[model samples]
Target chain A: MFKRSVFVAAYLALSAGAAHAEFSGGVIKIGVLTDLSGTYSDISGQGSVIATQMAVEDFGAAKKGMKVEIISADHQNKGDVASSIARQWYDRDGVDAIVDLVTSSTALAVNQVAKEKNKVALVSGAASSDLTGKDCTPNTIHWAYDTWMLANGTGSAIVKTGGKTWYFITADYAFGHALERDTTAAVEKAGGKVLGSVRHPFPSSDFSSFLLQAQASKAQIIGLANAGADTTNAIKQGAEFGITRGGQNFAGLLVFITDVHALGLNTAQGLIVTTSFYWDLNDQTRAWSKRFFEKHKRMPTMVQAGVYSSVLHYLKAVEKLKADQDGAKVIAQMKAMPTDDPLFGKGRVRQDGRKIHPAYLVEVKKPAESKAPWDYYKIRTTIPADQAFRPEKEGGCPLVK
Target chain B: MNAIFGIPTQALFGQLLIGLINGSFYALLSLGLAVIFGLLNIINFAHGALYMMGAFGAYFLLTKFGIGYWWALLISPLAVGLIGVAIERLMLARLYKLDPLYGLLLTFGLALIIQGLFHNEYGSSGMSYPVPQALQGAKDVGFMFLPIYRGWVIAVSLVVCFGVWFLIEKTKLGSYLRAATENPGLVQAFGVNVPRMITLTYGFGVALAALAGVMAAPIYQVNPLMGADLIIVVFAVVVIGGMGSIMGSIVTGFGLGVIEGLTKVFYPQASNTAIFIIMVIVLMFRPAGLFGQR
Candidate 1:
């Protein structure tokens, strides 16, 4: 009787082990790499982590018998630092995929590491169009908006509206140069003249000298090709100098909702910019953003929203495979599937790893127009997915052919 | 349209004026650094953090107590000075006998803690402090339009710089302070209360930075990291001016600011590097700094 019982127990254990193997090979870990203490922290730091957690919980990865774990680290917006972290995460920590890289330089660095290590990266925070253009990789997906899309959306819109003569106060860096180049193309294409440009040091507090140069150009619009505190300071000091009242407009090429909030309506009003997502855009966005706000105490910027959408879609691809999938294969599966999330709505990933979604042009409302807290942006029009970004053939991506 | 060296006159003058305004800040900040380093024999790396606190103090005074900018001009520095006294008495006083690098490192750590606290509470984005009604609008000089508040900043900082210069260089108290800087033990033998003088001198030096901060609150975005970067540039200014001489810091501060402004017009690429480049040149010519005494 004892011999029969022992054989029965061994048989049951073997069957259970086979069942687990069929469901998933082992635990899958995703790393959230972003700027935590530096300039981009407000938009992508802790908020992106929270958004990813929400997606993990909602996706029910564990119920499918695949244990998924999340980890995060601060990239500090440096390329070397980001590369080191990516290398360790991929080589040692078994971080299968990384998400939410903020600065473009860092994102580009991590993208190379991901490709070299055979891990996937979902870039939600970085805005350089080069990620999909010349630096395109099968291991990375450029989620959220990019510089080309922003320039095409806001630059052309402003130029078409007769604010034609332009001067650029560009931050002296890769992201700023790309933005200025793309926006200049957009303006010229719309029959606008490029007056001039001044490249200021990054994170400069005094925009007086730069603004003075912009003023001297006497352009109808001063294009700010910078982000974070640099843009906010330019707008604030522009108001102090009465740049707008003197008959010139300020076109913020890359403005976030948090930036608008920081500048407040009095300074930021009448400024027009482009974005991929806004919290109060529709019922679905509002519902998702409201749930996010309940936990984060602020509305979700598009980057934070993108984290949710991409992570959910990534998990879906993993589940469909029913085992730990390779990075390139997982990305291919994700590209094959359509992305539908409450925050961003339904979108598609292209061959060059650009996500297709309708981008919105928004105007900052006057103080009197804001009805409630975080009621900042008033949507003017939507650039349909096909028209939002540059055409595939023009981007020069190797994968496009 | 009149142009100078192929650059428009308005742009040139406008940038020069801006350079002068920036020079005013550099002058005040470096002057304080020179004064503290002379007597204390330690670099107060927390000077920038203290400047940031001064701006926050003024901001709180306005938002919390309905105190206006004019009153803040008086109260903010006093408050920041008191905090500096406490810091000197409790923390900095212990490091007086150690290597000066320890003092610098300790203060640097303190700077990070202070900046982190502000970043946690208020965030990295700037909070605008409104210009006082009495000092709004601009007076157009034919070359360029200069805002009245900017002009006020230039005039007031210059006056304060000169006033501090007079206090340190021309007064009886100044002589004693100078004597103590030479030999505190000898000054103590003369019944000069050397320790008390060190504490007050530190407080007064810190007050100069706070005054600049309160003055700056109206113009620049009052943010946490504002002082962090500016302090680095000011240190470069001190090195160029030679931290030994009061007037060297004052002159170098203003001179560098104007040079930076000029660079912005003729060559926009070198504006940020102009000051540092000049510092490198000056150090090669005069290892003790232009005004620094050996």
Candidate 2:
């Protein structure tokens, strides 16, 4: 009787292994919805799309007897547009998962749509911590860095290291509000004081008035609670307006490699920033980024890198589950299994859907210090994975239990 | 530290200066739009694209040919103006007899195509152009620490705005150009070469937009979408000041900029909306505009 039972169990296991990955219509479709031509485009647009493809190709989907199809759309950094595109992708196009919603508005919008449709949305581009906080959902995975991580990384570092009094030129949006709040908390915790902050319009090209406000506040540090074009423009205009000369330094709360490249080393030099990934961090990163650069001609930003990592992790979970039918189930599996990828190395998706990874605090290299084009950061310190993200209990996420 | 509406006086003063500096751009851009609409009876939606091209022209000249900012200030506008001439000759001239909406659609489509092409090449993060070496520093002017370049921009825009105003309102050729718009057939019968004159006027108006763009290159990062973001605001400025009134555009452009600046100081979040609110108020009150005649 024991021998018969053992043979039966082995046969059941073999059949189950053969039946892994019941892709919809014989394939898993991943939609990369991002800002293709707007303020946040360069960092997360075509580069992100290419990264998603590379992840699929590197995962060897064809060899695994699984077909993966990738499609992309420009959310244009608008919430309504993102929601509509996400609804169509999930309801009509059979996209099992969506990735790389760049702006916070788009990410939050798509997050809700994915939940309603019972599909997966992996966020690598958005920076708002609300995704893992009050808004955390079972059907979504918040990959890479969020506002809390950025504040905990760059904010604490700057405050503890002599940037005591801060005035913020905040973008007038969800991401900006969240960042300002988190950074304020981080600053106060680090024994620093926030003098004041002014909200500016989103994606504004002129920062003269806002910078003047910060200058007049007489703060030791001018914290930029914005990102992409808004941040870059502020930093450039700050120099011209003598905010730097007046001895008020700018702390770029979410500076990307593309933003740094656009600002050039001359202007961006010495600006402190926090990021989840840097291409030249190690041999593994260098090798992967080299392959990426060979394809995209620019180094991958953290958002782009996060997109690749999340897609790979999502794919693995889908394979393990033997189907992509249930979004929550797939996400739970993704959480149950530890994530290992070439971009972020070893990490895990927490119950609140936050991806845990080490963060880096780097200073923009002086023009003289840079050796080549795109050689931007001089990595100052590494924030270990455990200390990088918000604590689960403190995040107000109902899913934490 | 004395306050105005809870904002520090020093800050208020600084904001006022910043507003005027920004107003310089508004005046220049709206002035060009006013001139174009006045002469051509067409809403040239491509003004912003032409502005973008002007910045790119300066960027390319500097990056590729080692040309400095001074030469680019002149060359970019002229070069872009020539492109404007081609546009007028080939496309805009054909739309002269149609509804103004047709001209608007054509130019609007042109703007999209132009912006899309540049965006495909540059990807919209934007490229930085350094302020000229001579104007690289800032001067502490008590109320504000004004960047020398900003001061130069304000001064030059004032001179340019009034210079164009004088040429169009005072000179013989200016009257002929104005007359062509009033009575094109009569102007042509008088051997004024009205067609060529209209084309050159459009070119000149485009060049004025380009000039504003070249000046803006250093203050704002040169991006494909830079002009798109600001063009709508300039249009509002033109509307509020009374479209097609050169002096009206110049005054309201500067005035709205100052009001918007104050909004930045007292209520920083509504700075972008301040102008629109005023536009609504003016529209409800005056219908034609603050200065536009019905």
Candidate 3:
């Protein structure tokens, strides 16, 4: 009778498995929304794509009873386009999570849709602190850098050096304005004075006039409160007009390793900037970066590293839950668990959805200092994870309170 | 009265000089765009890419070929112009009979392909071309320090702008080109090979952009996206200067650049939007542009 009962149970389990496979069993989709071909493309596009694939591969390309399918699209730096795509992915494509959004405008737009739909949005690129602050959403996770990170990295470090007087070349946008404002606070707190500032239009091609004004101000530090192409142009022109050699230091308040690489170390060298990760910082970073570089043919920037870590943690959450799909439950698992990934060592997700991790202050290496083409930065200092991000009490995240 | 509303005279003059330097690039790039548009009727969207290529060509020539800036300045543009000619003959020529919009679309696509290919090879990090041994230092005027490169750029752009203007306005070939633009059929009846002229005109226009790029190499890092961003502003400048007149594009380009500079000095917040503001006002007042013919 016991043998008969065991045979009946095995037959019933097989029938249940067949039914489960027939109804819903294939690939678990993760949609990657990124600025693939616009102003911020160089900073996060191709590298983020590779990072997401790496995460999928690391997960054995399957979760639960389903294979993982990574699908991505270029947001083209448009917020509405990103939102529509996110909505489509959720409604049609069965995308469980959206990862590697770079621009804050696009990230916020996607975040809203994700919250309304209850799909997970992992942001590894966009750097507005508001992602975890006033604009924080329950379903969204800000996995990478933010305005606070930039301020603390560039502002605190430079301020300590008594390079206190500042003249800002700000991009006329939210990101640029926030970076300028935050860094200004850090500068003042460190006893620096604001000399003057100029706001350049987003995607300004020529920065001669702005650099000239900055040079004339004779401020000790010229803060470039911009990112990507704008920052590259400002630094290039600054070097050209001898603004750096004119007794003023060029401070890249928000810059990426790719920007430095594009600017080359000669123009970028001696310009102090802050970042969370430099591919050459340590053995672990080197090892991880080497694999990334070999795969992508480019060094991994912090944003790329963030993608890897965010996706890895997301998968771990999925594995722990033993469910291939379910955004709410998976997100809850993610927040409840401590995060560990090859890119970000060990970190934790805060209640506010801010992933706490260490940030770095790196200087651009001179051309001679670089042994390889992609070797661009040297670690100047490491800001502890606690000190790197804005404190929970000050973060203004409703969830945190 | 001497204080001029809390702004120093020296500060104001310094800002003006800065404006002139920016204006120089504006004039050069707009002049090149106008030259190409005059004959081709297609906005060479790849103009900025060609400019970026010129800079990279100079950088590579210097680093790899042991060429100096002066030689690269002359050679890089020619090299890039030749590439432009090849592109025109092989690809752009096929699109000439279609709507002018097709030319713009084709060139825009070409720009992407060119920029993408370069970015793939070089990455986004820029390569620096050093200021030549001769142009290494700066000179102090009464108000501010003037780097030789800045002075050189301003002076050279002025000469080139006027030179191109003179060529289009006064030369026999330019007159023939203008005549062809007016009525290519009539010009062909006069036994001129209008198509060849069109090809050469495109090449010359591309060469102007490449020349500007070569001049810019020592000033800016050679990068793929350098031209992509600048070309948009140049478009705005072209609209602000009316596309009909060569001299008009030159004047409006320089003038807007100066205004953009002054905006940085006074309000600072309005600097970025100042050019667009002027563009709007020009559209409101003249509709065509400041120098544009109705």
Candidate 4:
């Protein structure tokens, strides 16, 4: 009688599995909203799109009896444009999730619309900590590094290394302010002092005046709390002004592999930066980045790498659920599941929607030390996953129960 | 040992030098605008775009043709100027007799197209143009470490600004250009071939802007949208200078740059808006401008 009951239970489970498969009829569509042809494009543009496609293919959704599609649009780093695209994708195009928003403002804008429309926002390119802080939502997951991660990684390491005095040349915005605030706390906690800081106009082409102020501060380290074209221009012009050779160190608080490529090893050498992923970090990263480079003609930046990891994990959750549910439910499932990917390794999403991963403190390799193309960084230290970001309890995220 | 407003003299001098360098760009760009407005009666809104093109022209010449800074300095302006002549002859001449707003709108549209094309090709991340081997280092002038190239820019700008002033104020071409500005009909009646001269004048003014662009190439990033917003600032400079007197534009460019630099030292936050504030104040006092005629 017990054996008969067991056989009946097994038959019922098989019937339910088939029913779940039938319910998931349509294709899983994802929209990649990013700066495709702007300053951040080299870091998270077509490369990001390609990475998402690779993730979709590698996941083999078709083999698992599901179809997935990826679409993309250029946000142009404008918040309004990003929000509009998100609305259209969710309301009209049946997009289940959006991924890889480059600028922080644009990412936040999309985050709100994603919340309203009940779609997932897997942010990989934007670095603002506010996504998981005051602005955190149940429908969004900040997968990559944030301003907090960068500040903790680079600022603490530099202060520990005896570069005790610092000056900041910050981009004038909420992004810059958050970075400066985070780095200052890290520096002060490590027994360092912030001598001064100057905020330059946003998207500023010339940083000479600000660099001059940083030079005059005579701080042991000049921290550049900016990114994209602003960061590149500051570094290049800083080299021209001989700011690095004048006995003061330059710290790039948030830099990407693309930036180091643009600045080249000669100008970028000896600069300290923090990142969550590097293509040559390990065997798995190398394998994945090599494949990506084949398609994009460049190695994957951390943001691009994060896009792959987040999409792969999202697909895994979808397969586990076996249906395209509302974004909040899908995200809850995502939070419940452990994130394991080749790019970022085994990770977890906090209750606050912050994806936990190890960030690295890296120094750009000098021209002579580089052995191959894209061999740009020498890892100084690894920031553990738990300490890499702000604690969930402190973020004031309403979703963190 | 010296201090101004509690900031060290060294810091003050450093910012002053930077202000002067920026002033040079303002002067050159505004000078071109004023000259073009003087003859063409239309604000050349594409001046900034042409300036950006000038920088890109230098960049392409150096990267593609193996040409160095010296050759780029000569070729970029001439190349951009010729392009400018074509624009004036082909498109701008059509709106000459219409309201000035039409010319403004037409040029503004052209600026967008040019900027869009360049942005499409280059992206917004600026490509660096290296300082020439001749002027690559800084000179320790006891007050601050003055970049040699920055000093060179100021010197060259001063010479160029004065040279243009002389050509317009004292040369034989000056009389025809001024006479054309006052009475193009009369000048044409006198057999001056005013239409061809107008085209060449636009070209000449654009060439001046291109010259500034070439000079700015090594200092700033050679990017597409570099001139889009910068043109707004130069427009502000032009308005404050009244655009009526060529000398007024040059003097106001340098003087306001100095004042803006001082504001940076005393209160860094007001640096970007200070110029616009000054523009408003000047306009309130003199509606035409500091040097503008009714």
- Candidate 1 residue-wise lDDT, B1-294, digit = tens: 788899877678888999999999999899899999977887988999999988988999999999999999999999999999998999999988899999899888898899889977776666778889999887788777788998998899889888888988999999999999889899999999999999998898888899889988887778888889799999999999997588999999999999988887777767778889988998999988999887
Q: Write the per-residue lDDT of candidate 1 for residues A1-401, one digit (tens) a residue.
A: 00000000000122233356332226677888987667777788878888888888778665655677778888878888899989988888778889999988899999999999878999999998999999999999999999999999999999999998999999887788889999999999999999999998776788889998898889999999999889988888887777887899899999988888877788888889899999998898898888999988878888999999999999898878664447888888889999888877888999999989999999989999999999998899999999998888889999888
Query: Which consecutive 10 residues in model 1 chain B have the weakest lDDT in total?
Result: B119-128
Q: For residues B187-212, could you state the per-residue lDDT of candidate 4 as single tens digits?
A: 99999999999999999999988988
Candidate topping DockQ: 2
Give candidate 4's root-mean-square deviation (CA, Å). 7.6
Candidate with maximal lDDT: 2
Q: Clashing pairs in model 2?
A: none
For every model in order, the TM-score on chain A comes to: 0.93, 0.95, 0.90, 0.93
TM-score of each: 0.94, 0.96, 0.90, 0.90
Q: lDDT tens string, model 3, B1-294?
A: 255667777777877887888788878888888888876787788888998898988988988999889999889989988998898899889987889888888889889899989877766556667788898778888777777888998999999999999998999988999999989999999999998998888888888888889888777667777798678778889888987568888998789878877787778777767888888888888887777765
Runs with alpha carbons beyond 4 Å of true place in candidate 3 = A1-26, A63-65, A324-326, A366-368, B1-6, B91-99, B183-191, B267-273, B283-294
Indicate the docking level reached by candidate 3. Answer: acceptable
Instruction: List the candidates ranked by TM-score, beginning with the highest.
Output: 2, 1, 4, 3
Could you tell me how far off, in angstroms, the CA of residue A189 lies in candidate 2 after the best superposition? 0.7
**What is the C-alpha lDDT profile of model 3 across A1-401, one tens digit per residue?**
00000000000121224223321135456777887656676778777878888876665533334356677887877788888888988888788899999877888899899889888999999888888888888899999888888987888788888888999998877677778878888888888889988888776666777777787678989999888877887887776667767788888988888887777777778767778777876788888888998988778888898998898898778766666455666777899999887677888998888998898888778889989887787888888998899888787888876
Question: Which prediction has more favorable TM-score, 1 or 3?
Answer: 1
DockQ of each: 0.50, 0.77, 0.42, 0.37
lDDT of 2 by residue, A106-167 (tens): 99999999999899999999999999999999999999889999999889999888999999
